[model samples]
Target: MRFLVTGTAGFIGFHLAQRLLREGHQVVGIDNFSTYYDPQLKEDRNTILETYPAFSVERLSLENAPALNAAWKRHQPDVVVHLAAQAGVRYSIEHPQAYISSNIVGTFNVLEAARQHGVKHLLAASTSSAYGANLEMPFRETDKAVHPMTLYAATKSATELMAHSYAHLFGVPTTFFRFFTVYGPWGRPDMALFKFANAMLKDDPIEVYGEGRMSRDFTYVDDLVEAITRLVLVIPSERPPVEGDTLSPVAPFRLVNIGGGKPSPLMDYIEELEKALGKPAIKTFLPMQDGDVPNTTASPALLQRLTGYKPETPIGVGVPAFVDWFRQRYDL
Candidate 1:
């Protein structure tokens, strides 16, 4: 199948595109290489993918409607996976407009391209943060995601709504998966795992938010990609009510949670990193920042029911894998 994936330079995007290419699929990737984290890292990821004959990349942002439409018309992709976005919970509090432009406007452009191309399956990335301000233990796809604590989450929720509208009005089949805390080798520098790993290697103090009380279901990147690959074929066809399905009543759209299904404490994650690096981090406890949630756990029932798989890599193993990569990458 021919796949056009946005954010191919990003962590999950890179991994997903590689996985597809390894499975012998032709992939056309698009990324603006934003300075959100580091363009060097994005370039390095693209370099690796460019080595594959089946993979090709275009340098452009999704906000560029003409460019995006041109790429869509050229590739005529069988599937479109929209993963590019201004991603950061805390960063969203400082720069709300970035979230609007990238998450909102960027997603809008992707929807328009997909609608025009009449793609078979459109899979977009959402976040567990969409379940904001809800004290629920394990979030389900059908749960209310109306109360987003952060602008980033709000934009993602808005994208889901916007995609639903497009799917209903234009008959575009869409699947939006809400991700928990995703981490692994080639992870984003802005995420807690990368920040903690960098600080620990330098013997610097790691900022423990929520006084080390926060928790998250840290889904490994490879596992998330596997779920995504499987979901590519599980496209929604109609609005038939199925058990554990979040299928929209009016469109060929559904929501699934891609997570580990096991929420780990912030302190526990830190300890795992310490173990991985063979060094303890100087910890600085701080109150929770704005637009941050204390804990997030995914039910994963819908994902399992749909894909027959769930993320199972625990922190103990995943953290060490990332530490190894960090050490090799930085010559630590």
Candidate 2:
């Protein structure tokens, strides 16, 4: 299959593209290489992807509709995985417009391109943060996600609606997977695991958010990529609706949560990092920051029904893998 994947330089995008390439698929990657983090990291990831003859990338942003459409026309991919976006809950508070442009407008452009090209399936990334203000233990795909605490979440939720509209009106088969706290080797530096590991290695005190009360359903990157790979074939209109399915009645659209349905405490994750680094983190416990949630646990039922797999990597194993990669990447 020929896939047009956005954000191929990003953490999850890099992992997903590599997996597809290994399976002998042709991937046409698109990334602007935003400086939201170290561009060096993005360059490094793209470097590895470039080594695969089946992979090719265009340095452009989704905000640039003309460039994006031209690339889509050139590649004419069978599947389109839209993953690029301005990410970060707290960062959205400071720069809400970035989320508006990249998350909302960027996704809009991708949907337009996919609809125009009549792609076989359009898969995009959403976040568990979309399940805002819901006190449910394990978030199901059918849950009402209207109460977004952050602009970031709001934009992602809006993306879901936009895709649904495209699916309904244009008859585009679309699937948006809401990701949990994803972490692993070559993970984003801005994410919690990377920050904690970097601080611990530097002998700096790690700030424990929510006063260590928060917990997350952390899904390893490989598990997430595996689920996504399997989901590419499970188009919304093709599959019979399973129990707890979020498939839209009117549109060929569905939302699946890629998680283990397991919520581990924040402290437990930190402890795993400590074990990986073989050093106790100097702790600075702090209250929960604004736009932060206390916990997130995905149901994972629909994902398992659709793909017969769910993320099961525990922090103990995942944290160690990340630490090893971190050490090797930085020569620590």
Candidate 3:
């Protein structure tokens, strides 16, 4: 299968591209290499993908609709996986415009390109944050994601609606998967695992948000990528499907949750990191900021019904693997 994947340099995108290439699929990728964290890390990830003969990378941003469409038109992919976005919860607070441009406008461009190209399947990334302001445990795809606490989440949810509209009107098969806390090796530096590892290794302070009173699903990158890889082939054909409790019924689209199914406490995650690095972190307590959810748990029943798989990486095991990579990468 031929695939056009956005954000190939990103955490999940890089892994997904590599896996597709390893499985002998042709992939065309796009990334602006923005310094959301470190451009070097993005470049390093790109290097791995460029080694494959079936892979090609185009340095571009989704904000530029013409350029983005040109890339998509030239690639002529059978399936389109839109993973690129300005991803961060706290950062969304200070830079709300970034979310609007990348998450909203960028997604609009992807959907437009996919719609125009008549792609068979269109898969895009959404985040657990979309289940904002809801105190529901194990958030299901059928749950109402109308209340987004952050601009980032709102944009993603809007993207879902946007995609559904296209699917309903134009007969495009679209799948939106709301991802939980994704962590693993070759991960983004801005995430908790990477930042905490750096701080703990250098004896710096690791700020505990809400004094470590949060819980996250913490889906590992490998498992998340697997779910995505499998989803690329399982396109939703039925329009307005029925889901338990919640789901869209007018469009040929459904939002599925990709997670490990367990919400581990923030303190327990920190402890796992400590054990992995063999160093206790210097902690500083901080109050919860705006646009922050205290806990998130994913209900993967619909995802399993579609893909027959779910993320199951425990932090205890994933932490050590990541710490080892951090030690090898930075010589910590």
Q: After superposition, how far is residue 153 of candidate 3 from its true place, in Å?
A: 0.9
lDDT on C-alpha atoms for all candidate structures: 0.92, 0.94, 0.87
Q: List the lowest-lDDT window of 10 residues for candidate 3.
A: 238-247
Candidate 2, residue 222: lDDT: 98
RMSD of each: 1.1, 0.6, 1.6
Better of 1 and 3 by lDDT: 1
Using all chains and alpha carbons, the TM-scores for the candidates as numbered come to: 0.98, 0.99, 0.96
- Give the local distance difference test score of model 1: 0.92
> Tens digits of per-residue lDDT for model 1 on 1-332?
99999999999999999999999999999999999888899999999999999999989989999999998998899999999999988898889999999999999999988877789999999999999988978998888878989889999999999999999999999999999999999999888889998988788899998999988999888899999999998989833656889888889999999997899998999999998888889999999988888999999988898888999999888999998998888888
Write the residue-wise lDDT of candidate 3 on 1-332 in tens digits: 99999999998999999999999999999999999899999999999899999999989999999998888878899988999999998898899999999999999988888778889889999988999988978887777789999888898899988998998888788889899998888999888899999888789999999878998898988999999988777767843343452334666676788997888999999999988888788999999878888999999887786777988888888889888888999976
lDDT over C-alpha atoms for residue 236 of model 3: 76
Better candidate number, 1 or 2, judged by lDDT:
2
> What does the lDDT read for residue 249 in candidate 3?
60
**Positional deviation of 223 in candidate 2, in angstroms?**
0.4
The residue-level lDDT of candidate 1 at 39 comes to 86
Q: Which residue pairs show backbone clashes in model 2?
A: none
- Deviating ranges (above 4 Å) for candidate 1: 238-241
